[model samples]
Target: MAKPRIFEKPMGVRDFLPEFVSKKKWVEKQVEDCFRSWGYREVITPTLEYFDTVGKASAIEEEKLFKLLDGQGRTLVLRPDQTTPISRVVSTLMKEEPFPIRLCYHSNVFRAQEREAGRNAEFFQSGVELVGDHSPEADAEVVALAVEAMKACGVQNIQVAVGHIRLLNALLEHVVQEPEMIAKLKQSLGRRNLVEFRESVQSLNGSDKKQMVLSLLTMKGGQERLDQLAKMDGGKQVAEEVTHLKAMWHALEDWGVASRVVLDLSLVGSLDYYTGVYFEGYGSEGYYLLSGGRYDRLLEQFDRPASARGFALKTDRLVMASTQGPDHPERVALVYSRNMRYEAFQIANRMRRQGKAVSLFVKESDRSFDSLAGYDRVEEVIGDGNL
Candidate 1:
């Protein structure tokens, strides 16, 4: 490789400035507090895990993982997602704990991203995981919390679309006998490629079943839409899944987040581990803010039999959408002569104790008050005890 310039950083990574970081932290705190209010405690996990464990089990693609070898030559991976590592903790460390554990986290996850405009190799994510609950109520709870979290971040115009994977899977499996072909069509849906999906449908010999499946993306709305779908030819095949979604909708209604939600059968989740109801939240201008779904089979991979559901907010994106950040904390600058250094320290500490951020700068002969542009207030102290 050629010698890199000093200004260059690795592809897909980012450097957040102070202003951006302030907003990011604000968003993270809002989400954490919201998670806590719902009785979900926070937990921390290692950033690196054995490649055979979380690396392979994470919802991220294998090629997108940042893999390396430790001193022992065992392959290790920077965590690409939180779900797998949290599952590992639940199965091992929290094994003795009872079911229905509610945990939340704010962590930096790394996934190898290409030279793309909108992708980040390392980013911040904040979310919660509810384990050992298979009820649609659990699904509804996560969705509702997602709404509340966004509201806490001051992200307006939020729309959360919920879907049942079984409905899509059943319809595809019924029409396309081959699993690979069905997977191909699903890949198209996961990519949100309506044209490609229609093309894939047309390639399936133009059957009535293919046409019905083709309409799944447009099969989105509220109870009336659900009712319409439940009466469709293919919807009857997924009667149980439809019933699950209906129960979830009713639960969300009780939570009062139903107005911010829309039913979209096409949401296959961003991760494959999502085996049941899945959803994604969008901010204004179609910004993908967060995603979560039920992953009942994930905990089983770690030798623990339990159901789990969770969501992760793209913290960086939320920061971008946030119009407000923590004000500069009421800065106060303390200026003093060289002989009054000790007194300046005392005064600065006093101001800090009074809940203001304080900084001390020597009143040098060459210095101007203009140098303290960011300070909200400035006070100069003299050796004679004058302010």
Candidate 2:
């Protein structure tokens, strides 16, 4: 006899049983309601796109992109992020539709991750993009929308920390003389490694400029410190950026979301594409739940020169941060014969209409009790003795 063969699921992947499916549906509905409440219309885009298009503003460190060749022998890959595809759609397909397009989406993203991260290769994301407007109000709108989404999840302890790329860029453009030094500084900032950033700055010939850059890194958190940093020498342009940030801060407060907002100048987004204001929502437990920012130049590559802004909430992280006891209450299960399947389903439907969780399973044998016993909070099991 041939040896028996065994098949196993791949690592970092798991099946979603019925209970998990119900939880996922509840979470998705909450996100959808929050987005629609803000007048954001739902939109869908293909999960795969030309590799060149998706690669434009990619910040994925591990390039574990699932790349393949299309029928035309052109490179195509699964989309690692949604913003770029949506930008392409707005620029090419939705051009002449409307200004400041308010669009929302919920979909899966694939990423190649190292084992230590313990994250899935495929995960879900829900976010909204507000394009065609560049104003403090628009920035605040996106941030507020994220806050509302979190609240809709029954999550209360989240803070939105905001920053601006222009603030850092203004300082860099004036301080760094050599192109190589600027690149090194950008990498350091992206990693949030202040020590490396200081060392790289010191390697430069000028002390005054290096010191200024180092000091800027230290001047973080809240508006007062930002104002003080603005007064430093060679910091006038940075000061103007501060003014812009202050305006955005005020707008967030005016929208009544200031209590949930924080100013973290030291905060650096992992992605390099953000060109202006950047913000991330963090759970009270210190987990990053959502992130987004402005990237006006991103769409320029597609010949669409328009102001664009958006943010994405990690569905896995969101679910982890907001999980609670079962969302639905315990209910009765009705077991019946194959001949009574339709009648049992009708009875289950009526109970469901009364807002109950009713499970109708055919009794396979006397062991059905053992199987049903595995389900926690099973209030009662109703069945005929047909078995």
Candidate 3:
């Protein structure tokens, strides 16, 4: 007879061992505590949702969704993002809730990332959604909360790169009338491809438009950059947007996180649903830790058109960036012979009551006590009932 084969776990999936799980839980607790302190309540949504519902509002590509068919012949997908599903819940279920509903969630999302992307197919996300408020204060509150969450995770040397989608949209609307051309321009800008962006803008109506497009590609810094943008033609056209950004800056200052903020106008978000200010947080080690922005129109797909903004922290990446290590519990190994089994149980119970982690072992096993490497101390129950 042929030997049985052991099947391996599916690719892009991971089995988190206890040590890693402990660290992840620690990070989650810190984030949840911070969210609670800020008046955001925890909410949970289904892992599987209708493809049509999620696809209508999310920017995830159809091919990248983990899709299936329900018993009723309806299409279903493992949620590729949380914000859309949460929006569906709020719009359909919590429609009557008070204005500016604050919700926070810690859940895993599924995405079929390309193999070369080196990203897991399933990863955890911790985030918040501030619904029904359109003010610049809402935007600033989300950003500030993101910063606090990062600090809570023990991440240092953080920088929050703030940008306005309206700034880029305004510039594109001014230079390119054709939707196709504008999309190409945005694609180039999103990739930070200056040469390609410059080429795309070369067909613009005048040198002024081309220069403005080229300038925005590199226009990122502190208050000076904002001042310079305000003086430009593109910036002047969207003066109201600039004012909103300024108000957000002031709010960040009021939160005492202004020193960590930088104005990076070229920082366009990947999601098409974003309608206004968007920001991404980075750590000193060159990892993108968090990203979010205002998506005012997303809820309209569910018939609840309200202004909302929020951000999600990539928990997997955050574990890599966190300075804290996994907690090591002090463990005691309780060894026993068959005759001393009851005595061993009593000793273990006593140890447990004393708050010690006890690992019970039988001396009859082929393995020796030394084989248990992680235990800090090993006690053997002898025939005399003495440890």
Candidate 4:
């Protein structure tokens, strides 16, 4: 029989090598510490859920999901986003737990699209959700958590751009009460196209509110610009959301982290679920490092509706932004003599217990100690005698 060819991995997917593992774990630890301190208990959901179940409230368009059949001949698919599965867990599994469930999760998500510099078809995300509350303070807390998480990872030269979905929602309410009009406006917002948006509003005879909305599309930097915007808009919901956004902004100011924030009212999220404040973080590379917002209606689909807000930072991009190519942490090496094979295992276990990176190397017939140079550190010799 002829041998079958071994094809390369599909594009947009990657395998993490040992050198990347150390830094990846370091990033996870930072996120875990930040989330735990904020009272968010960690939870996990399966990597694959029934195609329909995971896609029910997913942000991914139906056409973009990667699907397959399970052993039982049932349709199944990889999760496209973490929050939806987490929401399902809270709603269906832990329904009676309590109000304002503070849950955190770290998982891989898959989609079926060609990834580019700013996009990925498969990626890792770490985030927390605060369910059952809708206060501006809760919103601020989520935003702050994202900022703190990035800072923990040694990330700098980044800005968290904040916006309110309500502002655009309100404008849609005023201009095009038609479903078609709303959908078209959403499409424009997703692309951030000022020209098309202007023509669309003009077609609807939108003058005052349209102009205001268009102006928001151009407000792209700093707090003073956001304050100027808040003073212009007025309406019950618009005014309330503005008040909430300002409060959140001032909270950032109080934390002395306001310099790293930018107000972007036109920053519409691609997800259909975000019904309140929306945000995305960008580094100097001009790429989104993290993206999330308020999805208050997400849990309701699972029959346990509640006000919820949170954000997820893309861990892979985080590694890219925070670690320079040559500076990524190297793997560890543990070398031992023939008589100390068992001791080598003991030492590696002890180092792991103390949260240190470790890899064991038992004495071999051919390779010399010079091979240890490949790793960041090495335990040269386990003494012949035990303590």
Candidate 5:
């Protein structure tokens, strides 16, 4: 006889039990409700897309993508991010639509992560994109919506750290002239390695520029930090970026979420498409629950350039942080003898119509009454139609 073969799921991938799936679905519904209430209509994009199209709009390296060749030899990839694919859809298909299009989605995104990190190879993301709007109000509106989404998930101790890529780019323009050197400086700052960042700044041409860059790496707080940055020596562009950020801060305050907002100049988004204000929400549990920013140039890649901003919440992380288990709905199991099958089903249907979960069980099978110990109620159907 041949040996039996065992099958297993790939690394960094997960299989959710019923309880976990229930909690995840609950979280998704909450987030989707929040998005819909804000006038964001749901959109669904393909799980696989042309590598060329997705690659052009995103900063994800090719190595991290799960690539495959179709029968016609065309290269395709599992989408690593939702924003790029959605951008392609809007730019090419919905070109004639009205501006400031609001679209939302709940989907699974695939990415390669280190095995030891215990991260999922596939993860759920729920987000919304506000396209064709570049005003400070748009930026503030997205951030405020992110706050509300987190609240809907029952996530507490949330902090949405806001930063402007323009401010960082403006400072770099004054200090670092070499593209490679600028890239290195950004990498160092992104890693929070102040030592490397300081060393890189030391090579700059001017003390004032070096001081400004160093100050920015540590500048994080509330409106006071913005006030201090406004007085820095980053010239015209930096001043404008700072002014824009201050305006966004006021807008966030107007939305009544100023208390949850924090100013963090050192905060840089992982993607390069972000052009202006970017923010990421962190929970007290130390998980990054949400991330978003303005990607004004992203649509240009698809031949329909327009200003856009959005955020994607990590639904798995939110569920893990907020829920203990499935918390399944109130359920009753209706057991029936052979003669009472019809009555048992009728009762089950009636209970279901009354907004209760009912599980039907026939007697003398593998499943016994003991198997229904978890149910809220277990009723035996008698031939006389009485429990």
Candidate 6:
């Protein structure tokens, strides 16, 4: 194999120059402020975690994990997602803390890409986890916070699609008795392949049962869908789940975010997790901005049984779509003749105290002006007086 070029970088990673960093940071600040207002405190975890623990629990595809061996020959993985690592912290370090812990984080997660598919191997996410809450209100809180965070980021036409996994599961259990077929149907929905889901439903024997299975795809729009669910014959279990969704929706209305959220029963994006009320947030042109839901079983897997839910914002994408990037600090150039270098330092020091960014330059024989391009204003000092 040939040596890699000097400028070559690993795929699915990005380099954020100064200007780009300004925008990314701007977006972060906006969302961070929104989170802080909601009483969520930030938590951070190590970039690499034990593969057997966090890697397995992360819910990210195994093939997407970037794994390596530690010095002890133990397997480690670049954390593919933040939620699992946070769960580990809550289960271990803060296990004794009181119920309903609220934690937030801004971190970069790594996922290995087999082939470059125009997706990042590493990305930034800002999110929160609310633990030890089982009420539909908890789910609605996350959904509302997701909308507020998106709005704080200046997302246009923000819309959230909400669904209850239990409802889907109950409907499936009522229709499809075979576990294998049920898993396959859910996989199709998790992948957002409605056509595949419909095809799988058609394979079932009963026409009425097939139609009921397909309602996960068709039953969407708004509260009307919830009302329709009440009138349907989806068994007692399905009615309970539907009632839970309706309660969650009313909670969203209490938060005044109902205008921005709509029902999408087919919104199951990977049904392996989330007990109920999962949602995906979208910006202009339906760009996926964030996602979150209830995961009452995840903590139990970590040796702590607690109801929890949260969402992670795609910070990089938010930066790209942000309406305005914060402006860089105004830069001042303090150029000085060789003999008056001492005077230049004093002036630069004063400006620094005044919250100005100062760049000091000494006049040489050539007097080249190339470096002055980035300065907003310039001042000069000759041997005797200012020039």
What's the distance in Å from true for residue 384, model 3? Answer: 8.4
lDDT, model 1, position 383: 60
What local distance difference test score does each model get? 0.87, 0.78, 0.85, 0.78, 0.86, 0.87
Q: Candidate 2: global Cα-lDDT?
A: 0.78
Poorly placed runs, candidate 1 (over 4 Å) = 116-118, 175-180, 205-207, 235-237, 383-385
**Model 6 alpha-carbon miss at residue 104, Å:** 0.2
In model 4, what is the error at residue 20, expressed in angstroms?
Answer: 1.3
lDDT of 4 by residue, 264-343 (tens): 87788864779988998877677578988899888888888789988989888787777432344345787777788777
TM-score of each model, paired residue for residue: 0.94, 0.86, 0.92, 0.82, 0.93, 0.94
- Residues 1-387, model 3: lDDT tens digits: 655466555558889998789899999999999999999999999999988888656777788899999999999999899899999989988988878899999999998988788778899999999999989899999999999999988898999998888877887776665788888888886787878978888877778767777777677877677677667665455777877787788888899998898888778887377889889998868889999999988899999999999999999889888897545667999889888999899888988988789989888767666677778988888856678
- Residues 7-119, candidate 5: write the lDDT tens digits: 56777888889877888988888888899999999999999999878954576777778888999999999989899989998987898998989999999999887768787
> Residue by residue across 187-287, what tens digits does model 2's lDDT show?
88788888898888888777877777787666656657656755655467777777777787788778888888877655668646788888999885887
Steric clash pairs (candidate 1): none
In TM-score terms, candidate 4 sits at 0.82
How well is each residue in 24-135 modelled by candidate 6, as lDDT tens digits?
8889999999999999999989999999999888889899999999899999999899999999999999999998899999999999887748889999999999999888
- Candidate 1 vs candidate 4: the lDDT winner is 1
lDDT of 1 at 103: 94
Model 6: per-residue Cα lDDT at residue 352 = 93
lDDT of 5 at 375: 90
> Which wins on TM-score, candidate 4 or candidate 6?
6
Worst 10 residues of 6 by lDDT: 378-387
The parts of candidate 5 lying over 4 Å away from their true place are 1-7, 114-117, 175-180, 202-210, 323-327, 365-368
Lowest summed-lDDT stretch of 10 residues in model 1? 229-238
